[model samples]
Target: MGEAARYDVVQISDFRLPGGTTSSIAEEVRAQSEAGLSTALMHAAGSVTGYPIPWSTHIRRILDLPGVHVATPRDRLHATVLVIRHPTVIWSTPSTFDHVTADHVVIVVNHAAIDGAGTRHYDVEATDRRVRSLFGLDPIWAPIGPVVRGTVLQQTTEVPLRDEDWVNIFQMPEGAAERETFIGKKPVIGRHSRPQPGKWPDTKEDILAAYPNSPGYDVQILGGAKIARRKIGWIPDRWTVIPFGGEEPFDFLRRIDFWVYMHHPDLREAFGRAAMEALAAGCVAILPPYMKALFGDAALYAEPHEVLALVDEHWSSPEAFLAQSRRAQEFARSFSPQMHLRRLQELGVAVPETGATRQDEPAVAGTDAQAGASAGPQPTFVLNLDPQDLGLARELTRGLSATGSPVVMGLVADGAEKDPLGPDEIRLPGPPAFHLVEETGAGTWRRYITQRLRRLLADVGARRVVTVGTTIPEPVMEAFDGQAVEHHWVRPDDGSPLDVQLAVRMNAVSAIAADAAPETLAVTILKESTL
Candidate 1:
């Protein structure tokens, strides 16, 4: 592997490695920049809070390199194994998927130069599937594992055709029922309950004080020290307090009366994995209202604070609880593992044979920004406003002009305003390179947005459509044609208010890229220079 006079090549790095694993990736990239080599690094999206969100913040920081592009390790490993046959290959990013193949190969570079770990490990099943696709397999392909396990489990059992009288509820041993047996199902709280401040009390004294026990009903506290500490003085003599160990959480769920629990306020809680297990095990569950996003109507939602109140209303009525429990069982049965596979197949992701295969040649398309003619008489951006967005709209146009970009601005109306539009209304720090026009009309809102856009694009030959916010609406995405509009999902950098600078930037570059032939960006504004 010597230097080449002309070639397009990539280098690889694993950012998730231990400090000493592959530290060289960064230095290798810096060296390549010095040597005039094209390079990119691979990083996974950060994992979710409880789930270990893939492509974590760490990966994001690493890939924010000035000139480097980002790729996924899952894709890279596949390319290395199938196409390069080497220990490493520059993992291809989503943007680069169609460009590379097994036949046309290049030299592999490691992140060791930058002290990068070789390749980070992930779940074998997930990695294998990603690798298969990188090797030119159809994206719809998958490996057999839990997906299959779920199917096998579903096949061996039979849920009662109709709702059963007894419903069991299972969940994390964190919180217990505010009011058990609100409906027909008895409350079978988790066995591994942990005591957390505010949510759980050190003793059930508060709960008992809140509600004196009636007949046929008892409260049990589950989990380890967390549960024991919380239920210290709370548990009644009749109810059994069990310490859950190993993966027998579900086994305990099987012995439960009903599932009752609440979720965190973030609304990111899992939809009762234990509840699902209980439903399979023939238990009814009473869910918190927030769970509708995941469980739908399968579980009943009691207000988080109204547990005892719920027991008084729903639990006290055994007939009502039984009916609700039946619904839960029916709903759980609908999500059998075969149903998952069937759904995937329906989505065109599981076709046994797809016509998608790797091409011998690279893609040639309009994907990159064309080294264009010099910036024209600064861009004159026209901020077209509807009646609702006139004020902020004006501010946006003014902001752009203030940034030294030429901008013309206006409002859309059903009819033209008789009063002449003034420059004070249109001009900000910078002047419009051309005349700013405001027009109003009916039955032409789409035409108005488009015409204003085209006018601005043409006047100064603008290269981008930068909007002040996402509230610009769905119609805009459709009007620009789905192929061209790109949303800039901007998250705040300084921990500003969640709503603070949410804007959209329609990248003419990406529009051109999508429209490009094969992999080559076919159309770009050719920047011509003055003599």
Candidate 2:
């Protein structure tokens, strides 16, 4: 870019990095435009990897380019070329560039975008269509790959079971923990499948009715918050919604009884992770007929949309689900974490078995910290209220209370504080199950109420902590440091981040513990005597 600039000046703009997008970019472009410099617009394109980009984000970047008119010889020499496109912006959502306006858009396409079959064939088409619909023009589709196609999606290889008995983990709808024991344990049926369109059982009620008369049979539904909510609505009374009370979904997957493939016929996968996990857990795989291709005779196959039939005939028949579970264990004894890492390394991704990726470590840690409240077993759950968003709060409380004893600490403006449930308070789904802790402050400033919150958490329990704050507080962060419970911050709408974080943290810690100290971790694996 500098060499081209030596021949002629260039000022690049983008929606990534510091000041690449947002008001700063607008200010920069406005400054240059006002300075009478002739500017050229350069736009970059690709998938948005991880950073959050919305439809109007590109406009912010375009607004920051100062030389939109025409660059003079002096302008060309002195002008700084701002390259706004980076890997992060490309891998994210595609419709993030609708509002952007550029005189000339230059796309920096990477090899992944150019040569990858998934990207070039499907993703690129979808992205271009979206851009055209929203922006009234199509950006360039530059191919930078060396005209070579990579391998088809990899197949799963089995890994050794860490445990003879099946263990599964998953995030619950309400932030809660669940553990169930099958007495006699003769026919333990582990289901690690999800509800998919037209593939999963018609409803939770119908699925629950499967093997209704059969006693000592349990089915645990594992999923994140959305799935948890759906399960709550559809769960068969016979099947229990077990909250793998953890910060990460994988933690719940780690402790499941066995794996069931519930994907719809339309959906195809290169590899079935949950099915592989069931094999790893020494459980049999009861796969849908369609996904049998992915597993072959290694797993037990059943028709889709027939969860009840499968449960009654295949799972409920004498020694059926159990027999299949053992076969699954034997099948999944080759795909280790080391193998996954090695594959990524061969792809030039340089994934080390230990240490961290230079780019992803801090962000991952920060994300984990934010998602997993650094709390111990008996930690306090903080609930901040803005009289307006009480509906959301009540929904959270209802979900939490169903799984664990949640301590709700409500914060309000000085004069606004009233009966724990004020005259204007919306009726909670049920009478408040939470122990009410109140803090009164001058306003919604989180800093002002941090001291009161720290005291409240200490008084309750500091082992496991979750907070719902309208705003992030410096004091609360300090309190988290002191208490060590995973802390999470959520906007009013995107509340699931907290749930997923908790699920992930629990799984990671469980993995770390199981890998490091198998004996101690085994005892805590929810057995009769331990419970």
Candidate 3:
């Protein structure tokens, strides 16, 4: 197989798992690959511990990149650097990967906390020792940021975390074409995070202090205020409560004057990636005083009670507001992919000098960033799916993808999610390609719809909904942006003639692959329904 396809770098992480790790690693790989490097990304996030975390869409999208390979398990790869994020996988099972040989360095970037309170917390000292024993090379300990570093310092008698912070690598979304200092209207203040209970302060006063609905200010929260609403008891009259992912990250950041973030007192704010993204968007970010170590002058910090006065101070002077905004963007460069590439080189990875573009920070918002401003909302297709329909969903997704439009599929099942195929019946669906109908532990599949896919549908403006062999979930229905959406029900029974007919139409869909409009595909599917 052509000398087994050697690579310059091999990155391992549990990708099927969601959240920022996979996406951050993918961004780093993309940057390296763009600089004319052969990089291999592997999904080994839960492999060593025998957890069955599945492949994520990030890995799928990453695989499509020109020089990046999503390496399969046990695929022997030669590399100069073998970078692993949150390195519990190797620390537990030394044989988890016997194939990757890092000729120079093994950079262990920590994305998790050191405490074992969570299910997947990593021990920094243990990981460093283990990597040294396993590879005979002392691995570089790179904490994501001060928050992550704070945890590492709790027991720093063993390994010293380098001064260079391996903060979460992020690419800012399209920025607002015009930078307004909020002079004419009330200064808009907001924050974006998941609607989890731990994301907020303990009291209503503190919550309102951070997000005031005062007549002098406008509050726009992109993440749903479920916990905040529960704490406040009554929703604020003027606060524009947008469900998380209801709008693109940059779009929401653009509307706000300041990116105000405050976490629950009990939980430590470990490297606020969302806040960093805000800074990259040139939005003035205000966090609690503790975040000052990581953000410094790039963002502002104050206690809950002092937030508005800080805002008033900034608003009183347009020059100060613009200066803070510009400072935010400048500080965001420290976490860009170019900085990641430089970080990789510091650890002995021989990055090629051929790509001169490697010297410059990547342009986060350029002309293409302005496309979404004028381009009206794109159509989204939400495929209501069940475990029984994964094979069908997989096929349909292939056809839908060719249509050049976004698709949302929420196939997660509530309660006890057994495998779709019973022990006695194996022929229908076979071994599944996607994740389960249900996943136990922290990120339950039932919460998948409410937490993730629903917000994604909202963000993309899902206009057409299709349910095959099952009724749409009520939770999904509640989140659909009102009225414009069209819902269609396909054959209500699994393995019905509807499957055969639709499968044939989907197979024929390749013929119309050139048709990029989602409306075209929707028309074809509805036309086949009558027969």
| Winning model by lDDT | 3
Lowest lDDT block of 10, candidate 3 = 421-430
Pairs of colliding residues, candidate 3: 13-45, 14-45, 16-54
What are the Cα lDDT values of the candidates? 0.35, 0.36, 0.60
Q: For residue 518, what is the lDDT in candidate 3?
A: 44
- Assess candidate 1 and give its lDDT: 0.35
Instruction: Output the worst ten-in-a-row residue range by lDDT, candidate 1.
Output: 107-116
In order of lDDT, best first, we have 3, 2, 1
Which digits, one per residue and each the tens of the lDDT, describe model 2 over residues 395-514? Answer: 544444444433343433212122233211211111111212233221222322344455445444434443443443344454455454544332355333434444343321221111
Q: Stretches of candidate 2 above 4 Å error?
A: 1-199, 203-216, 223-235, 243-258, 263-270, 304-327, 330-333, 349-531
Q: Highest TM-score among the candidates is held by which one?
A: 3
lDDT of 3 by residue, 1-531 (tens): 212335667787666644456667777878887776667766654543365555555555565454554454454445677777756666654344544456755545554454324423666677787777756777767777777776767656567567777777776555434355563477888888878887787799999898887888888888888999899998898898888657877777777788888777756666777787788887788888878887888889988888888889988888999989888887776566777778777766667776443211111111121223224434434343466655555455445545553444433322112322111111111112123454422223233333333433443455555544444444344444354555555433333233344334333221222123344545565454321
Better of 1 and 3 by TM-score: 3
TM, every model = 0.31, 0.33, 0.62
- Winner on lDDT (1 vs 2): 2
**Of 1 and 3, which scores higher on lDDT?**
3
